[model samples]
Target: MGILVFDDMKMLDVSGPAEVFSEAGRFGAEYRLTIVSVSGEPVRTSIGLRVPADAAAESAPPFDTVLVPGGDLLPGTPIDPDLTAAARRLAERAGRIASICTGAFILAAAGLLEEKRATTHWQHTTLLARSYPSLRVEPDAIYVKDGTTYTSAGVTAGIDLALALVEEDHGPDLTRDVARSLVVYMQRAGGQSQFSASLQGPAPRTPVLRLIQDMVQADPAADHSLDRLAERVRVSPRHLTRMFRSELDTTPMKYVELIRFDMAKALLDAGHSATEAATLSGFPSYESLRRTFARHLGVSPTRYRHRFTTTRPAVDATRPALPDVPGNR
Candidate 1:
């Protein structure tokens, strides 16, 4: 396998799988690894560490696999066309082409993701889809296997995807060995979004609280004052507050904010403009939207859109709307 590292490339993108393949030595000498870059010179990783490439891309031997990683690049970003073209040429002979995080951007720009079901860092899914309309981007997937291409979600998910590759190429026993040695989880069953959402405070329970969740998701833009919501559900606002704390573990207003944030994320993922997403999500202004986004998600709406939104496509028409409880990720 050949890992083609690039400028400002996420170090783990190269090292994660390299270590996985290297660790295969513990089980048996099963795979070969070569790290290459655009030029023969050493390059710096995102963390300011220097990594030396075994050879230049032009001189590297053909390999069965190619791996790429993501980094912070501005939208409509211009890249060295020649370097990208070289990577694309190398990919032609690769049995599998994979990317971790925004590294999918490089693959997509090379037209490798065309008409493929792929995913990237949640924040970049929309922009990747928008930039490459033919690519089918699944926001809720931890990793996507589209024919010969395997794309994974943000940061640590790369390790999971790499382990999956090890299992596919060798065996489950070898993968387990690598996992045990690494001292990390064997696998993350769901998408990265679930892990990210788990960082949100606890969810709500109880019939009234559940009803509130349903109503908020149904139409977050609805004029959902706590008093009106309580009255319609046959309870006083004070009782609603008590129930919310008792069951959901948060106040009614805080729960509303969470619901609104979820809706805004949905809208943003669906390709709505930030201004439109803010208004539809019940935030009084874009500033409010940005503040809540930073407070809850650690990213701005624009940045989130840059990472996740390209074109707003309708959700699955057959799935029922969110019920009276928060939907599982």
Candidate 2:
């Protein structure tokens, strides 16, 4: 596999999959990894570490796969023409192509993802879709495979995409071993949303907003209507709504719902029944919880719990009965 690297690129975007493939090599897999740059010069990473390139893009050999890792490409900043051209050339000759995070922008610049279903970091998905109107951008996928071209979401999702590639090349057993060695799950489904409810809440900007959030979290079942919140904060309902929108980028009720959903997920992960979780988390009914789970998490509460619950090993029942040696009983 050939990894295309550039200045200011995210180091993990290149290293994560590189490490996976490197580990796979230890297990008897044959993966010849090469890091290439536009001119064979050492490139500085986003974190200020310098990485030496193995070859210039112009001289890099054709490979089974070409992987492009993302960088900090700010809006309206033009992609390097030489880099895009090299990607086009390499992609045209390679067996398959993939991009990590905002590297989709580079692929799109090279016309590799034209009319293709692709995804990028959730934070950049809208910009990508807007910039490349012809591309079918999947905002929620951890990674998307369209034909031989693959696009992955932000940072760590690249590892999941690379694992999928390894699984395709090797098999389930080897892939599982690789994942085990790396201490990450074998794979997260591509359709899983990139954001979890716990990670979605924006930080409260002011003491009033913080206090209101604390109160809502303290009692999810309380009457957290806009008027009630406004009364607690001594503000008009309209001002409260504006403040919430400004601070949280969401309405008051939506923030409350997010908190409730997060609490419900925690309850479910702790092995609570769905109906009980719904009741404790302030959902009006079990159906409401189900709908919220489906809407935001792309799975039912039961499925989410089953997928995410941490299991402990069961006790052995037939271990010689401990010899029944108690204190003179």
Q: What is the TM-score of each predicted model, taking all chains together?
A: 0.62, 0.76
Q: Report the lDDT tens digits of candidate 2 across residue range 279-313.
A: 99989999999999888866778766653321111
TM-score of 1: 0.62
The reply for model 1, stretches above 4 Å from the true place, is 74-76, 190-194, 198-329
Which 10-residue window in model 2 sums to the lowest lDDT?
320-329
> Please, what are the lDDT tens digits per residue for candidate 1 over residues 176-271?
778779875555432335343422555554667778888887888787888889887999989888887777677777777877887787787677
Backbone clashes for every candidate come to 11, 0
Quantify all predictions' global Cα lDDT against the true fold.
Answer: 0.73, 0.82
Query: Candidate 1, 7: how far from true, in Å?
Result: 1.7
lDDT of 1 at 203: 53
